[model samples]
Target chain A: MTMIQIRDVNKRYDDGFHALKNINLEFRQGEMTVLIGPSGCGKSTTMRLVNRLVSPTSGTVEIGGRDIRSIDPVELRRSIGYVIQSVGLFPHMTIGRNVAVVPRLKRWDADKTARRVDELLDMVGLKPDLYRDRYPSELSGGQQQRVGVVRALAADPDIILMDEPFSALDPLSREQLQEDVARLQQELHKTIVFVTHDMDEALKIADRIVLMKDGEVVQSDTPDRMLRRPANDFVRTFIGQKRLEAGGAADVAEREAGPDLGGFVMADGPTVNDVMVTQPAVTYPGRGLAEAITTMERRKVDSLYVVDRQRKLLGSVSIYNVMDSYGDEDKTVADVMMPVRYSVQSGTPLTQAVELLASHRLHNVAVIDEDSRFIGLITRGSVVRHLAEKLPHGDNGEEPGSSTGLGPQGGNREEHS
Target chain B: MSAGLSFFEFLGERLPDLLLALREHLTLSLIAVLIGSAISLPLGVLLVYSRIGWLNSAVFFLANLLQTIPSLALLAILIPLMGIGARPAVLALLLYSIMPVLRNTYEGFRSVDPHVLEAARGLGYSAAQRLLRVQLPLAVPYIMSGIRLTTVYVISWATLATLVGAGGLGQLIVSGMGVNQPYLIVAGALGAIALALAADLLLGWLESALGRRFGLRGGAAA
Candidate 1:
């Protein structure tokens, strides 16, 4: 069902400045649609017009098939929730009173108002016992924004309009609230028209993202489709961050590990424990190749343990770590060490193990078991030799990232190309 | 010091008149304030919302214009038209009372955050509902504070009301001033000052108590 329909809506300010021009959009019931754009792009104006905060200069705004102008403004307001960037909590009122303001204005009884206030506080992960009595001024920006959302949620409107509600919060707080709001949307299935300038924020919470620019929509599509196949260069750049670690994700993902690694690795159930080094030589993920190269040279070890904070090896480096030393071994580990997300459990299939290394371009992968206890290791030299003896690379360019093993049957080498 | 009277006689002789005068003083103060707040509350909201757009500037201009009058002259001006008694006294107190109430009311409503107004409008509240629910409630502290200060000013000035033949503690001081009785003058003066102090304490207590109970910010800050 179409919860809100905006047909050629235009908003021209009193000064004759047109903020939105001939816009057409529809928000479906129980789905979350995010509007994202650069500043002055009319996304915000579009949001304000839905509730008649700013009336359309022409065309119609319809909620549930009827013209919004025809509904009594008060009745229409009680049925829609709005949360804003500033949170806009009435500092004079306690959280409970703030939440109850709309219902009380709708003339709800005291008993019902009290119950609804508490319910909303709880729904927003705030304990009514503690938060209900506190004034807005006492809460942090994030807490106040949540209270703001609850206030909008108070009357249980079928549609919610949020305008950069979490923009003022710190990164961690914003992420947490994003998670909370995403969970809420999943559970409640309320039709949401959310507006934000941040693309990452839009991606995190929106089921469908409307990429807008200069008072017009450039593209509107499902988040996955938009990410996987951006319509244009603007979209590709806008949605670029999700694939922020782009080229490497396909190289590192278990499914996209190329075939060369599979041809060389040991085929027998040679678990990571049997061959993995407990302490080949340790190095910080930082310090580029300097520490690892020194550890390799000084300790006279072929490879160094690139264990993370937990002392679990990420991947090992040998000639690869030294190969870069001639250029600048002093570079930070984050700059040089291959970005790896794969760590296999011991006793895994040789094919599965081969997939992990080729995708990430790791010379070797640490092995663990069911309990994630470190067990052993596997190498590209061994895995590729194994794959070359197994199957030919029929589909070469279809690198889907998650595919374990897909590469030309050739010798494995540490090279960017 | 009266040439023949002792301190006890001084106290005893003036006590009854002063008490009666105090009663009248308190009465004038309350009546002026109650009326002042009633007028100023809506006046304040309009002063803000109108923004010089809808209504003529006359009403707002009058409120600004009243603030400039001297309280004594206002009482004298009202005396001839309203008669010399509580009516004239109350009228003068009302004039004095408006400056603080009107100014505070206007300020309180004007100070309401624009973001809040937008949020309320976005939530589907009509202009009227936003004013009542969002703006007015948020402005309550400033409004109460305006009236609170106005109350003190009204009561303090009501002592001057006795000059117009309105019975209040000022009557003792006026009569004492007429007879050159220093003790009586001091006594009446102290009584009015004490009443003002007591009023401040009482109003301060009431503002906080109500703010706590109904989610209002207390006083001018509320």
Candidate 2:
């Protein structure tokens, strides 16, 4: 069913800037339709029309077969969730209060509002007990955006408008959040109109991709169809030749070789920096053996990298080495640590890193920057998980830790130290 | 040495008169600031939302004009209209108080982050709701500073009220100058200074307390 229909909509600003030109589009229920284009292409303007943030100068926007102008704009907006690139989490409000904004506006009782706030926070992986009372400034950029997303979903609106929501995030967090949105959409089935400039992001999460240019949509098609059969040269150029060719080849290979072989079709695969776990278990070399063991125990890792104050990787310390020196209270991590035998540069290809890990029988390899600063670690689990995410069916029931010597402990160890 | 001793003796004798003058000064300053705030706050808010550009400029022009007028000259002008006593005195102080409060309130509302306002609108906040819930709370620091400045201005200007026979601390200074009594002028000047300091201190405390509640620190720039 068509949830929103923009019929021949044209938008001209008061300054006489024609922002949208006779654009017509329909957003289906339970499908994410991404409006993608270069800057000032009116993709954001088109999304705003659905929520009445931008009123059309000519023609009408209809929600559920009724003209949007007929309804009060404030009331209409309340029924449609909106998230922006800046995240716009009210700095003054606590995380819980921020998430409860729509619910409170709709006049939900305190009990229900509180429960919904907690539920939404938990849904986005923020523990309500820990984050509820904290202010937005206390959170990192990615965490604040997570709050922004949950705040939009607080009222459980059937329609959501996302205006370049994840573009400001780092590449790793951006990918993680893209996956989160995809997973949430699968579960909630909301009609989402997402506007972004990056075609890769649109292709990753959008069920339908609407390519726009100069205030007009060039093509509106499924991600697969748009990649395989671009409507025009502009669409082809915008989607990029590399992605187009890779996507087309992947489609054919998926049909012929089935889902398991789908991960290898892309010749321009991810680099180490794209797939490596950025926050790995690490400790200072000056720390005593007892402290090193404590750090490993707290991080839930069998081994940790020992770095100096500048985060220059010096060596690695296994739990066994710490246990062996447990009797000697005077011994430090510098004494028991083994020299770093294997490492890769930050932008080294994942295929090469995978080959090194497989050939050397190493559990994980350190990823270093130009200055030899310990930036990330590519464990066997990270490689397997990255490959699993690439498959059409993302959750392939393949244990990321099954083949690694260190078991599940060698997966991803977030740095809290 | 004798003059200083005699000054203390004089203060003892004129204690009731000094107290009466202090009360008058406090009353005049309070009434002018209260009425000034009553007029300027809503006007400032109106200016923030008003689409008529000339109207905003005209209001600011009038306020700037008022501020440029000498306090004694303003009182002299007001006497013919309001005619003596506390009324003319308060009218002058009220005019003087308008510019600071009005400018601050306007700036406070205008300084609210546009992105936050956009989010509020996107989340379904009505115009009034956005003003009251988001803009107003965020503008509290700037507004408080404005009120503090207005209060100090009014209190200091109230000392000049005695020229119109309003009989505040200015009466003591004027009479002492007429009679060549230095201690009288000192006592009246000290009283006015004390009142201004006290009012500033109290308002400063209130501003910081409100600032903390609103998630601002050290109040916003005046």
Candidate 3:
């Protein structure tokens, strides 16, 4: 069901800046719709209209089939939650008090408000006992934004509006918060209108992505559809071709091959562990050069990872390194082994790991667990084989600019040449 | 040494009169500040929320004009209206006190982070609620500083009330000059100075207490 319908809305500021040009949109219940564009494209303006933060100049916004203008703006706003890029946690307010603001405004009982504040904080992974009494300044940037999210959820509003809420955070914090919102939406099922300039963020969390440009929406589609069949050249370019191919590959492959290929459909993008070689060739560091060379030959590998008794990766001994030290009778694998340079954490997205490999021109990168203990290895062969199995026919040539592995400019192409 | 002893002797002899002057001086300064704050605070808040640009300009212009008037000149101007004594003195001090308190209150509200106000509005706080709950608490430091400034100004200015027959500590200095008694002049000057310092210290303590309670530094400075 459509929870919010913005019908033919137009907004022109007093200074004669026409911010929105006859926008029409519907936000479905229990779905997140992201409004994205370059700066000044009116995405923020459109989102603001739903909350009556910026009212339409000409058209009407309806909430649950009733005109929003008919309700007092303050009352209407109290029924919805809002978050902004700055986090905007009241510095003077404790985390508990900040989260209780909406409840207090709605005149929820003191005990109920306190319990809700604690529940909301705990929901966001912030311990109520540790963080409830702390002010926004006392928390780190990520923690503050978590508080901001909980504050929005305080009153249990059925709708939430987020305007670039995580944009001010560092990249790691931003990604974590994005996942948090996606997870929260799964449980809460709130109708969410999120506005941002980042396409990756839009794709990561949005059930529906609205691409806007200069006061107009260029396209509105599911992330899969947007990636596979871009509405126009503007969208194709805006969502770069590399991302399109990577994101759409699995879906397009599944569609062509039908239900039998369902087992290989990675609805979420593949992670490093999905394609990593769990049991790569290993050699003890104290082993002689001949022994390491024998291990590499037996495994049909060019290198062997040297490890201690605990299976913690010490370094790698390559065939060439073995040859260089073959004449030294006393030399062990440790004496000639090169330090492992490129490694990724276990759950990292495959595309990022692949980019790391392509950018640095590495044959393989080690995958480590949280303890920094080696778990597996993601090699070029593993990735190519995974793609071949998923794509099946190697018929990705239909897409105008599609290139396998990394892209035309990637080091993977250099290896082919 | 003899001069110092005589001054002490004079203070001992005139203790009741000195105490009376101190009481009158304290009363005049305190009353002016209290009334001045009651008027200026709301007016400042009104100026902040008022959409009329010229009204804000006119109010600030009148305040600035009032401040520029020489203290004795303002008393003289008020004489015809209030007719001398404590009434005219207080009216003059009240006028002087308005500028600092009003300006600070206006600045306090204005300097509140726009993002915080936006968050408050988005969370469904009414305009009045935003003022009382968010903006006012965050602006406590600035408002306290304004009151402190006004208190000090009113205290020092109240000494001049004796000019209009108000008979504060200033009368001791004026009468001592008539009798060629330097101890009397020193004593009156010292009393006014002590009161100003005491008031300033007390207000400074109050400002920090409010600042800590409201988390003012965290919000305003951060």
Interface RMSD of each: 2.2, 1.0, 0.9
Model 3, residue B5: what's the lDDT? Answer: 65
Residue pairs in collision within model 2: none
User: Model 1 — interface RMS deviation?
Assistant: 2.2
Kindly report the docking quality category of candidate 3.
medium
- What is candidate 3's lDDT per residue for A1-417, written digit by digit as tens? 999999999899999999999899999999999999889999999999988999999999999999999999999899899999988888788888999999999999999999998888888899999999888888999999999998899999999999999988755466679889989999999999999877667766889999999999898988656665667768765764223222334433444466544434444567787666666668898899888767654444557777888878788877777888899999999899888877899899988887887778777788889877887777664564445345433344443212434322121111110
Best by TM-score: 3
Q: Please, what are the lDDT tens digits per residue for candidate 2 over residues A1-417?
A: 999999999998899999999998999999999999989999999999998989899999999999999999999999999999999887667899989999999999999999999999898899999999988878988898899998999999999999999989854467568878988999999999999987667766888999999999899988755644567668756754222222223422333465433555343556786567666778898899878867765555667898999999999988777888889989899999889988999889877887777678787889999999998888755554444334434334443333433222223432211
Give the distance in Å from residue B143's predicted Cα in candidate 1 to where it truly belongs.
Answer: 2.1
For all candidates, state DockQ relative to the true structure. 0.37, 0.67, 0.59
**Among the candidates, what TM-score does chain A have in each?**
0.63, 0.62, 0.63
Candidate 2 lDDT over residue span B1-222, tens digit each: 245568779889889999999999999999999999899999999999999999999999999999999988888888889899999898889988888999999999999879888999999999999999898887878888898999987888888999999999999999889988888899999999999999999998998888777666453556
Per-model chain B TM-scores are 0.86, 0.95, 0.94
- Give the Cα error of residue A194 in candidate 2, in Å: 1.0
Which scores better on TM-score, 1 or 2? 2
lDDT of model 1 at position A196: 93
Worst 10 residues of 1 chain B by lDDT: B213-222
- Between which residue pairs do clashes occur in model 3? none
Error of 2 at A295 (Å): 28
